[model samples]
Target: MLIGEVARHSGVSTRMLRHYDALGLVRPTGRTAGGYREYSADDVRRIFHVESLRSLGLSLQQIGRALEDPAFTPSALVGDLIRWTEDRLAREQELLERLRAIDASAPGDWQDVLRTVELMRELDSTSAARRQQAVLARPEGESVPAELLAGAVLAESDPHVAGALRWALARSGGDGVAALAAGLRSEDAGIRRRAVLAIAEMPEAPGAVAVLGDALGDPDPTVRGHAALALGRQGVAAAVPTLVGMVVEGSHDVDAAEVLGTLSQDPERADRITTALAGELAAPTADSATRIRLIQALVELAGTSGPEILRRLAHDDDRVVALVASALLRVLEERSRTNRADEDS
Candidate 1:
């Protein structure tokens, strides 16, 4: 087989085969009668071997050493190839994501595309302050795409930067709700927590309420707590149980109680809220602290049954619970009298 025949049969270009010969990677075994490079069967097999190794990302020099050096081991070189391939793949994936985000922004021109790319770079900066400024410094009329903001919001670990990102997302009028909603289903609890926090601030965002409602069942208590508090403020009665549990468990109990108090303004919800608090106080597991917190929450309720519940607790065996209940009972009574007088007037 002459060089031309080898190039045709083995698919290696003649120029490349000559280069391979010069490099001593695949020398032909003999010369043809016409003085063209002659490749025997072994040379053709060697050419195939060289092509196969090249497919695995081997450098020409490395392939030369691999074929020529008896002591050259493949394990370390193969491992290196794997790492290089992984790094390339990761870079490609990041570029793909960046392009997708930019496309999602729906830029009007190349300038808009450049600006969006710049903002994305800033959002990915090592300095949290720079990331925050990137979000805060966005021009008033220039809209940063909600998809970009949502992606930043989910990945940001800095509390301050995260807050700015959420604000920008909210300003996008909930366009990012679907993206943030995707974060809610993340297997990473931290991501779910961040998603709920961002969604919590966008109460008026389309689908924000429904996303928060779904987050109420999140496995993370922190996630559930944030969702419940946000929902409670929106007058969703489903948050009542979680709010009451917050008061009992002492997790954001003050905010939970305040939201519970606001939710209690609905007369029907007021009954349920009062009943739930009373139930917690009456439970066998109710300790002094839990009972006191429950009692404090009870005072925030706006129903006739509040004072009655407090009165029942005032005679309880726990002195602290009894004292706190007794004091709040007078306050409730005073509030009741004031209401009655104002109504009469």
Candidate 2:
């Protein structure tokens, strides 16, 4: 029978039949040479499963993924769906309470309007249970759903949520780097900060690099700081360009310079490294503290490069500066002696 006949007999819409067919949920018992769908009794049963799930508030997309392959565990989706529905109910209840207000004509107020705005923003930002459930409703291989991600941002106010998300991106067997990166733009500063940290820790993925690279430019200093540190962790030479830009922009020159030093053995960019340290040393806003820290770090890690830094600080006019410089030089000298001794053995 054709789809219209299946719709009449099974009481499932022809559109749904087409969608289910697309999902491999129901195939015609046989297709006409012309490719029109021809359903059988088994097809009707598949449609029943799909319709039943949809009626239960499962989106068509979710129902198709579930019943298209019964192996698709509904358990995978239930917890997320419940959270989304509950959140919606809570918002509606709050709206209803406002509507019952006696003095204000029971219409929309500024608070309601603002809440709605936040609701929309949340739809764009994170991937909490509510957010992720919606993503699950999307077609397989589809790019991430923005609204679904927004709900995840709402949960970011809780530090534990942000921590979990960070850990998930870095540690979980899931796909959510993009979802968490979306949190960086959240109106909530703390959420953005935590999101950056999470993004910072994600295993090196193509999108992860780009997302964290962009985050390094976040208007928030804390976010920028986290981004700088995260990119350094990846040790990708590509991040060097973005880090350089941040320093040039004055977002955090000292940190950027330190991170540049942290870049993997980019012996080819020795000049850039030299330029960065010189830039930091010359930055008018760069304080004595930042320079001292940078020099100490360079002395500790850069081997031969440490000599110049030690030379400068050890001989500086400032007595305190010279004392710290002398200490670092002694440490480096002792290490050199140890290495020479090991060689003799």
Candidate 3:
């Protein structure tokens, strides 16, 4: 076939076929009397092969080696192509997310778009201080979309930056709750922990209570602890068990104790909280430190059984438990005496 016929038959443009010939990628086998280039059947097939490789994202140079080099194997080249394609896809995905964030901001003009873009870059900056400043630097009356803050809060690892992001998210008036809720479902425990922490600060946010209730069952103890504390402060009794567990385990036991004390303001829950602490103290697995922590927690409880439980612990077989419980019992009695005196006076 002549060049035009080859172009027509193979769907390869004449100019491209000529360029391929110039690169020695696919040369014509013969020439007519007029000296026009002519392609044999095999040459046409090579053109098709080059096109096939190009479809797989192979560069022209790579395709040349693939077609001409006898030692070239598809394994290594295909693996490299896969990696390159994946990298491109990841970049594209990041760009799409950036665009979505910008659109969600609802910029009013080019200046707004530029400002939003700059803020996003700062949020993604390697400097934690810059990231935190980005969250706090939004000018008064310029509202950032809560979704943006939610995404930042979920990914921020720096404690200060994370706190700033969470603060900004809370100011969004619960608009970020949906995004934070999605973070709760992430396979990454770190992300889930951040999500719950951010959500924990927004108790008044719509659906915040429900999301926190769900997080009570999270496998990550930190996540559960934060959720439980948040719920306990909101007067939700469901958090009593986790709060008690936190005290028993000595994980944020002091804060856990305080929240438990607050929850115990209810007469009914006071009994249950007292019993749970007593049960932990009596468990065979309870160690000296565990018993000490439980005793301290009991001191925070208002139920009548709390002192009696401590009284029994005061004479326990463990000398340290006996000493610690005896000391706490005195403090409790003293505290009671002070309250009674103040009321009487």
Best by TM-score: 1
What is the C-alpha local distance difference test score of candidate 1?
0.90
lDDT of 3 by residue, 101-188 (tens): 7888888899988987898889989999899989788888787878888989989999999999998888865378888999999999
Query: lDDT tens digits, residues 118-143, model 1?
Result: 99888889999999999888778788
Better of 1 and 2 by lDDT: 1
Local distance difference test, each candidate? 0.90, 0.62, 0.92
**Clash-forming residue pairs, model 1:** none
How far out, in Å, is residue 16 in model 1? 3.0
- Residue pairs with backbone overlap in model 3: none
Model 2 lDDT per residue over 213-257, tens place: 787677887777677767776775555655655555555656766
Best by lDDT: 3
